[model samples]
Target: MTETLASTSSPTATSGGTPPPEAAWINAYERLSPRWQSSALSPQSVIPIAISRVNQVDAGRLDIEMSAMLKEQMVKVFSVMKPGLLFQYEAELDAFLEFLIWRFSIWVDKPTPGNALMNLRYRDERATDMRGKIRTGLEGPGLTVYQKILYCIATVGGQYIWTRLQSFSAFRQWGDSEQRTLARRAWLIVQRIEGLYKAASFTNLLVFLFTGRYRNLIERALRARLVYGSPHMNRAVSFEYMNRQLVWNEFSEMLLLLLPLLNSSTMKNFLSPFSKDKASGSSGDETLCPICQTNPTTVYLALPCQHRYCYYCLRTRCAATPSFRCSRCSEPVVAMQRHGGSVP
Candidate 1:
């Protein structure tokens, strides 16, 4: 994979569009009544169930009941999820992993839900807030890097709201505009992390590590992104599949691995292709990918003669050659295929 100089820059604001100031988020938090904020910030606000522990040696046991907020509302919000999974120490983490397994299984076994986050509302009535629409505006046919970053955040949040909330509550509770901005930051963080992990230069790590057991499912999850450079997709659900538990499990596992990556700055680098001007349709002639025609695939020059080919096509053709031969000159095929293929 190509290494772009790493920078700790803040995620770009929507081009031609300004971001709401930080105070806007603070203001949103302020919008919540004092009582709500007081409660929300408290550990009890979200967890209503009572927690009890006993010291075996002392034989002194303490039981504390959860606040009404948890019993009446918060827990209900998450009731669809298994109990003892939210914050059950090690057990909780394991539960989370199991949740992922269930989620992925759903994607693999059934028809994935269409418009996963279509219901999400945007603060500005004129502005589209549905994840798909916002995503299109940001990473659609002619999106910019800024746009792709924006969309990645939106799309990630839309699909993985629960997991993200578990890891970053501040983001979950953010106001509409604030959520967008924070989501951008989260995406950058993940990108950087993924890059760091990838720097080791293992081409098959994603495949080798994640492919077995969930092989078909993994491919389905990654296929559109790898092939079309689009990350906003409604998962495919198989017909007659009602195994929700299995589906949720797979999704849960996928998120545990995916959430951290999206939160890393290095991991954000992988999003380059999605934001490249080619996808945005801004490059005119320079932008279309020859192989797919829908997006601009990265191009590379062959050795000696410097003939160019779409990175995807070049790989297949070059692999059969001995010295990485130039298609035009039919020279030797010697160029080594890099990890993660080439980015457009």
Candidate 2:
């Protein structure tokens, strides 16, 4: 009975002989036992994708600002040369900066400054196989050398070429060429192409909203998708400064809305008593106008206060407000007099 039980559990006994070399042996208990299985990683939500786009926009803005600063420095260096000369090469300067960014970032399989901030990197979707263990749902193969080169050509070179073409066509007035002429036909073709591109972009945007992949047409064409670089890393952006800025912006807007309605003269009169110079009982400067705070070209004196002021400044104030008071002494100015003459 003991021998029969042992034989029944063995693979050789089941086959009536030794198992074939190709067949693998498994313990009965191991075969019957439940194995641990890992759940598949979930697809990324839309929020991170949107944040990545925002980061990209910010990176572009930073690039533009840097370009402007570089241009300013270059202009300073060539200040003695003809003015507006550097403006002619502005487009070239921008293209050069963009090329440097692409050369270092995409070519090296490194995340862009924007993508790096969000812990995201581009992955070649065509080469990625979904069957393997994917820890963050972002695991995939990095862009190949060919893909990187093509990306640079498509993004940087393509944009520069298109821009130049458009500018040249506009400058040459291709649209205003003789009817049915080649130039006119070319212009119409360009317009149609632009419209088609815009329509395609709109469709792509809707699809992206539904699926949360491929933020731009270039990305969609290349199959280079942004994915998280680190499974454990969180977003690096902080909203504290943004919150403060929003609060200040709201406060400034409110002030702007309310300020125009308030009486400027009343507000000035109300705040005048708190003035340090007024409290000290000293007319601040004899040569400088009390209202304008500059050396008066034609000095005049307020009737009761005798504070010196510019002729136009005092005349406009008295004309606008019949009850115009001395800015320094807070006394009613009934009339004005030239600095060396009697009251006029």
Candidate 3:
């Protein structure tokens, strides 16, 4: 939820331990070429396949993290509004979502094999003319039909896909209208999510292949020494979770942003201690709810306080009091959200 503003300055050489991707890849090829020399498949034939798989793996990891993050965000945002329903639908999508994530990722990444562009090998090594300068753009006769198709999609086509389908406005209105069935809407959202990830993965791979880095354009410009004559812009972003202290102005701004979600009735219900239905079939340990001194099946978490008690038990105490404070820390409970449940 928190984003740090990168300094707007000329990008200096990164001081990280990892070498540039170009360097790492060249080193890999050098180490592998000797062992592959006598094999039926040359490094050219084999390394592409190997590297393609590796790229696919990287794509998969990126997709998974994004999926989990998006899911959690969507769940949190909508949870209070439709308690049991959102989670139920989300549960059904889990298997299908995983499949879709993999399906599109593999398809998008399949073209990485022999992709000299992806490996940042813009120059053709075979060219003896031009003093070893590699050809830029399409490699003419050397590039195959499949490779061309992949390259077009990976670079040129993917951007359009992202702009057309994965824009924030498009995603904000994710799924179908009320006229459409939930199933249909879910499928549509899946397709969007699929396209989004594919476009994202391809774009990221393209960037990494080209630049070997993860910071976005905003990050790059900030890290640059000059943004059109201005010195580096100091990032106004805060890492709230990093225990960074905030001035009164920043703290007030955070509170303003957080106010909407907290003051709503839906949020209150979502954060409330469990009612009878919550504990009815749910099972729990023999240890009594800390507040109630009864073995409560339904648990409530007072976050930031971390002391969990029976939902009913905590709600009773908090509701009875005016402060609505966490029983342990006595932090005023301005915000609270539930984190767990299994849909049947």
Candidate 4:
């Protein structure tokens, strides 16, 4: 797994090289979400800062400025990320990145609060969809690395691409071999993510893949880092609103890269195999998994959270210990059970 946490070694930028824009953004994300930072912040804050900072500069004029800014920010974000967690949750990191791109794209064009908020919701849905696509065998390949990166960035701001993927399905509708081949390649990216973060536990997987409408909060916090400002508002939304939580400190940049992969419906469908009730509840008669439908009879029912998982799926997850905790809710699971167990 790639390192999730940033390097402790400070960033050393070669001034001559065309520095990656994300590098600076990553650093800013870290400084704002720092473990030692006195204030606690939600990821939702990343937006307001971006909007306000670049508000004065048009996209064309701000290109160079944003590039420099991103390099500065990335160094900070990567420095604090945990390498082991990155290795363990590499797939998740990528998925998060894919989600970010989808939403970021939308926000770049329309940075309104409503648009920004919608993008975060779109991120969760997109991530959930990508999980599913991986399982159902419909994701298309043929996208170049640049295309993947652009897709991820675009989706970061919640640029909707579900229609695009579904449109591609026209080929599958007619049984086109070439189309299916492309879908398979797209599906592979999500599969790779699941394998990387498999040990993250069902709840963690859910929150990591879905939930957390706090992108705006992160944007705000990040904005503060750039201007050395403080948070000025509350970003909490009630459960009725379907709020989801995503970890930022150790996983922001990796999350940035995965944004495109999560944008796919196939990826969301594959992840749906894990559980429903996001918070807690019964799986009921649903044979297909809530996140990814492929795995039936999820042998492992994570206690407390009640998320179910197929035995092989659970076994494939890597961890140093047999006992694991739900990544979504942070509840502990003593052992895998055939049936769902009560929270204790």
Q: Estimate each model's TM-score.
A: 0.14, 0.62, 0.19, 0.17
As a TM-score, model 2 comes out at 0.62
lDDT of 1 by residue, 188-260 (tens): 6665765864654254444434432111222233222111122454223243455777798899999998897
Poorest lDDT segment (10 consecutive residues) of candidate 3: 222-231
**Decreasing TM-score order of the candidates:** 2, 3, 4, 1
Q: Show model 2 residue runs off by greater than 4 Å.
A: 1-81, 177-180, 235-239, 264-344
Q: Is candidate 1 or candidate 4 better by TM-score?
A: 4
Which lDDT value does model 4 have at 337? 62
TM-score between candidate 3 and the true structure: 0.19
Preferred candidate (lDDT higher): 3 or 4: 3
Model 4, global lDDT: 0.41
lDDT of each: 0.39, 0.74, 0.45, 0.41
Identify the runs in model 3 with alpha carbons over 4 angstroms from their true place. 1-142, 167-179, 182-188, 195-344
By TM-score, how accurate is candidate 4? 0.17
The local lDDT score (0 to 100) that residue 145 gets in candidate 2 is 88
Name the lDDT value of residue 240 in candidate 2. 93
All-Cα superposition RMSD per candidate: 35.8, 8.4, 27.1, 32.6
User: For candidate 4, lDDT tens digit of each residue in 213-277?
Assistant: 22232322222111111234222223443333344433777877888666344554567668474
How many angstroms is residue 270 displaced in model 2 relative to the true structure, after the best TM-score fit? 7.5
Question: What digit string (tens of lDDT, one per residue) describes model 3 on residues 154-212?
Answer: 43345444445545435566544653476557558768788886787677657755654
